[model samples]
Target chain A: MAEQAFVTGKIETPVGTVPQVATGVSWRDRWGAFRVRLGFGRMRYTVEPGLYGVGAPRQDSPVLVTANYKLSFDHLRTALAGHDAWILVLDTSGINVWCAAGKGTFGTAPLSVQVAASRLAQLVGHRRLVVPQLGAPGIAAHAVKRQCGFSVVFGPVQARHLPEFLGRGMQATPAMRRKTFSLSERAVLVPVELVIACKWALPLAVVLSGISGLFGPAAFWENVREHGGWTMAGLGSGIVAGTVLTPLLLPVLPGRAFSLKGAVAGLMAGLAFLAVLLSRPGGAGNDFAVWAWLLLIPAIASFFGMEFTGASTYTSLSGVRKEMRIAVPLQVAATLCGMLLLFCARRLP
Target chain B: MRRRQLYLRGVATLRLEQDGCMGCGMCLAVCPQEVFVMAHGKARISEQDACMECGACMMNCPAGVIWVQSGVGCAQAVFHAMLGRGSEACCAIEEKPGGGSCC
Candidate 1:
């Protein structure tokens, strides 16, 4: 009995996967044929910014630094489908390079040690390690050079531009250095934040609707159904705008601060709410409701949008601090005032 | 690009000890300041002032060797906390169990 024990069954959890190579030809030119692809299969390894050989290449290939997130790693590898490169992954706790760099995981000292431990010095003859532009917040090129005898060369923000960057002898033009937050970029964010927000909103809605029943079926129930629905819709749309649309249209949207851009988007959403309200037949008689909306819609949208600043690249710590000092109280006051007016109107009637 | 260091006043007086660092590289991975570096096979605080004192490194460190007594400067988080949700619930609002209003 002690010698043999039977294990009947086990369940395998599905971790995100990535493909080793991409299929379908993308861009074909004199140099080579590029392919576009997607996969969840990323090499399972802790990022330590050391030299890594890809596709059985020897150690002397061009060293490229990236974040540990599987997606980030896949994108980096995908863009270099036909090239040989030494990928140095920084330990970012499975976060993307840009966010991790912003949080400080992809910085100088760890990078140096990883390089040493990975025996990067012996692999390549040249001391130049190419790092992404966004990783600048955490990495000091000068420090890495002094410590590891490797001069850090800053690369383009987009992995797709790697060929062009390397072709030009590591010179990054304005377009390469500048990061773009496009529609595709913004759309990807919607699922996560919306999923997170809805988890809370659903339960609260159930409770609010429940409590309103105690005041009498006709008035309180009606109020909950109508007003509660409006609030949920508005809150949901605001979250979508800030986390999705705002970042996607970041350049086209107004103002340098992400909050301001989010505010502008929220204002657009507010106008849409007002339009819907005005379109109703009893719109004029419900002046108090209209007023409540006028105060609250933009405020809710603005607050939601402002919350996204933490996740964006455009906002600075000091700038966010200053914005919060001014923006928060105004949002709270507006929301409270709107709630109070609506409550008063119902109570009196 | 000229790397810009956003000047922070309070962090200068704060003491950040990396002496007992296990070289697990978690701090080097999470710090936004490019502050930590490995010297003599151990992690050390290289750039002191660049730290925003985000305390993410402190929170995520497995060994609890990293310590930074810092607070979030985000107004939204502060507002949530002022509304009675603890400040710890601030920056990580999305990470909350049932993500919703701070209440």
Candidate 2:
């Protein structure tokens, strides 16, 4: 396969345009779907840690660094198109460079060893290494310099803008340094999350609806069916709210913490639920129904909204911690209250 | 505009040396920061400030030329580290906002 061919070669790193699995290979295996065979036919495309070529030049080219993840190698190699360069791959257990660097896999020791193993000093003409910006946290520049006899220069965050950055002579502007969660960026995450959730949510919804049908009044059974549909809709809305709307409304969201923003979105979702209740127009329904409606909907929405913060450019661990401390308990209590309300409503009329 | 340092005040930084760069431009292409640039047959650090320390560039460089420490930006990982659960890996759990565990 073309994907595997790229994986095997050292001189040319494939660009991002290539799919994970090339044409001709069974598409099902490449996607890692259709588990019916259970490892009967598995596909792999991860790059092994070692030396590589970047750009178009031969052995004497500049050496770039990255993890053994094929995609990461592909992106870096593909970006260099016309130039010849050396690539040093680290062992990050198939994780991407950013995360591996954070965890110290891309740090000093491996770099020093890879440099020695690759005999990089003998292969290249310079002693300066260009490093990515995101990896800065894990690397101790002074330590690396002492060990490798090379200084470290921190570069921009994105790869596409490299040509212009190079044209401008190694200077980064404020905009270049700032990370933006663009629409396309946000949209990419939806499929992965949706794929994961679709597996469990569907079966759970069916079970919950079946349980609701066995107890309570006709209204409760009706509510259960409606609840299943609403729950599914809520999940989809959560994706839209977090992935689509959050990025667009990021500046205007109510709180400093993403959870708070989600909570606000949840409040809006709660109002929608209220509208549903109002449409029924039943006098003297138990407060349980109202309480449940208020609590459950918002909690669901809030949960999804908060999850988006993990993927966004903004948001801090401590901020998330504080928000969780307050929000989780509140959500749990609200859900319990809603269930209680459902019980109280069942006892009435 | 009230801008307070919410949580990431003590974050980290990764630096590369241009003198050691072979102009592979590998870091230049993979970084989310647009930090590295190619110049005069070598890769240079065009921008140093935009890095979040994710370290993707360092891991993917084939020449073993990149070096950096990186971690996920999600709150769960940091929270775990703060709670002394530093070894656990936490990813984004789409529906459970603020809900992460030690494992």
Candidate 3:
């Protein structure tokens, strides 16, 4: 594909790639971010990997580096809305810097390759590249300087602090480098978790409703109307507890294992389920629905909790393994017990 | 100032090969958590209590002294494992789940 030519609102660099970018997020960017939260067209959310002009940057401007993932790119540019900096975006294959760094795609090879390909040396007078702190995993600073003759300086952990970081002579306070998974960040992840779980869950509910026909139409529909609602609620709350609540409340949840914490959250959600069911008299046989949710909700929540550990800033692979050894079987046992209760509930007089 | 503790106890998913450590400050510089401190210029684990185990130090260490079984910690992988399939839960692993709808 031909490299895009210089446009009216773009900064032209010597590299021949005239990357166009505006200061704040466009409506498309906003909509795209919102769409991603809902798990719609997530993989497709990528910009072309190359250099972009944040403002009218000069040759002496400090060059900031980032991943080609559109969301990551947008965050960087948007944060620097009023600044003039040369943004050199590497092709991380649409993955964010933090994740792509872990996967090894956003490493030295690509950084060097993009630097050379973009003719960055000729474009800028300095030999320093400002990289995001999270991309430190994939990058070897000394090696980049050795290979490309450009020293790498990792910026603050959050791009929001970019202005302060730059204003303070590019030095980060300890707080700036600190990685925080705030409540809002944790909550933002819930929509996608809910979307993915519901993909199979809603369908399973429909199929299970049909399967309930073996118990006769009246019983089947009764099961469909009563048990199905609880099942959906169980699944929804489980996703919330595991992915959102667990991470947000990770520090407070008892036990070291993520699954354990999730189970606690699930148990709470299960109690809530019971309270709702008790209020409605005909909501499935009281004993069966209560027993099933009590078992199932926590189990489902446990799985989500352990899963959230993968996304957490506190989990280890070894820790996760240890957790799995103990937690999985228990989660399975609880889930199966719930299923067994449901199985028995289906057949009762 | 003390930060809020968010991790569980005695479960730091990290290993430091003391023999190979060049006492380089890479781990100290790269770690987001205050997991390491330089003692006599040697990288030592002062508080591995809440290490996110992102493996930035492991990846950046010139001496290859740091080790972390790094991968995404999503529960979906556990779900896959239960189904007798690879826990393709994280993007860092051999395969990514759902065509890369990572959270």
Candidate 4:
């Protein structure tokens, strides 16, 4: 019943009656995807794992396999607008195709089990199942064939190309097979990154502002208004630099390490913040505080930038470890030194 | 413009034993980075640096001749690992009472 919004009808197969899904993505699906991108109910967004039909699939229709994540299912069904296809979804615990494949949930065992559970052999006359290319990391084609009696054909990386791929007899071109992190792809990831960063940064900003009032010759509230405002600005700048600027300028930014690129973006943001601080009347209060902002902003930004490696498509575990070995120590040292400077600035007359 | 997006150089842990290769070309087809290529009827490591160590080739290779220490290149996961949370630290929802997992 939860999936009734997308399920338009039911198709009767030799095995049983399968839910027939609509090929067009409704406004509800779009809203759901947008909410997930904004970090709402992301982990629970899943569909029922089983066999589904699109456009009245027959026994000879090509079988397309995917993860149980609702987003993945929506994309696949939406792509096959006019085509009749059987969608065999594996239980990946709501994870997308690529990440689930890496975790082995989309691998041979689950595929084999789903094949048997769905009685796919009896429903489909063809012996081929089109799995997403990204799922290759977890699935052994030979092993799947040996266990389930279905030959696995790795499909194109994106669902948009499904129509063309199916049209060409399931043959994917080199471009279709390759994965590229485009501007839009990088942009879409930014919202979740910003939301995550803000959850911690906003609270930290308030604490830093409250601590800023503990010193200075001015009244506690006035100092809080001036110095505390500066601290909040610095934290905000770091968040924007790390989560927004770093991802948008990922390719063109200097340095191969994500931390280094983040530091560069942080430096730019820090300089801008400093310029604004200096330009304001009576804004330049404690010189040590200025130095603190310079160091702290970049350190914070660099750490957030490094966090993006997990979301990136090309970073390796070894490379991330190597970068962390050097960058983590430097970031820690900078943060400590910056905090120490802030203490000195506040304690001084 | 084709901006070159390169990660750390010469640090990928991917290794392939040429003798055990079956020339199935599965590695070539599955590799998103195109790290493998068919050379003289055998799969070869064409671009070692480009590999993200996702282990697609190793998993799909029927011969089981490839080896790579595969894991996510995420700093949050590394931090969790440092806290002894193990390598499976990925996007798990409600990992704690009210704590959400990092993506």
Native contacts present in candidate 2, fraction: 0.22
TM-score for each predicted model, relative to the true structure: 0.65, 0.68, 0.89, 0.96
lDDT of 3 by residue, B12-48 (tens): 6688877778886877777788788888768888887
Candidate 1 DockQ category?
Answer: incorrect
DockQ leaderboard ranking: 4, 3, 2, 1
| The best candidate in terms of lDDT | 4
In order, the B-chain TM-scores come to 0.62, 0.66, 0.71, 0.84
Comparing to the true complex, what docking class would candidate 3 get?
acceptable
DockQ: which candidate is best?
A: 4
Q: Which stretches of candidate 3 lie over 4 Å from their true place?
A: A1-8, A216-219, A282-286, B17-24, B77-89, B92-98
The segments of candidate 2 whose C-alpha lies over 4 angstroms from its true place after superposition are: A1-3, A7-45, A196-204, A218-227, A230-244, A273-287, B1-73, B78-103
Off by over 4 Å in 1: A1-51, A207-223, A237-264, A281-285, B1-103
Candidate 3: tens digits of C-alpha lDDT, residues A58-164:
88888999987778887888788788898888877677888788767789888999999888899989899999989987898878988899998889888889999
For each candidate, report its DockQ versus the true two-chain complex: 0.08, 0.15, 0.48, 0.64
Candidate 3 chain A least-lDDT 10 residues = A1-10
lDDT of 4 by residue, A92-166 (tens): 878888888887888899999999999998998889999999999889899999999999999999999999999
| CAPRI quality level assigned to candidate 2 from its DockQ score | incorrect
The 10-residue segment with the lowest total lDDT in model 2 chain A: A34-43
lDDT of 3 at B80: 57
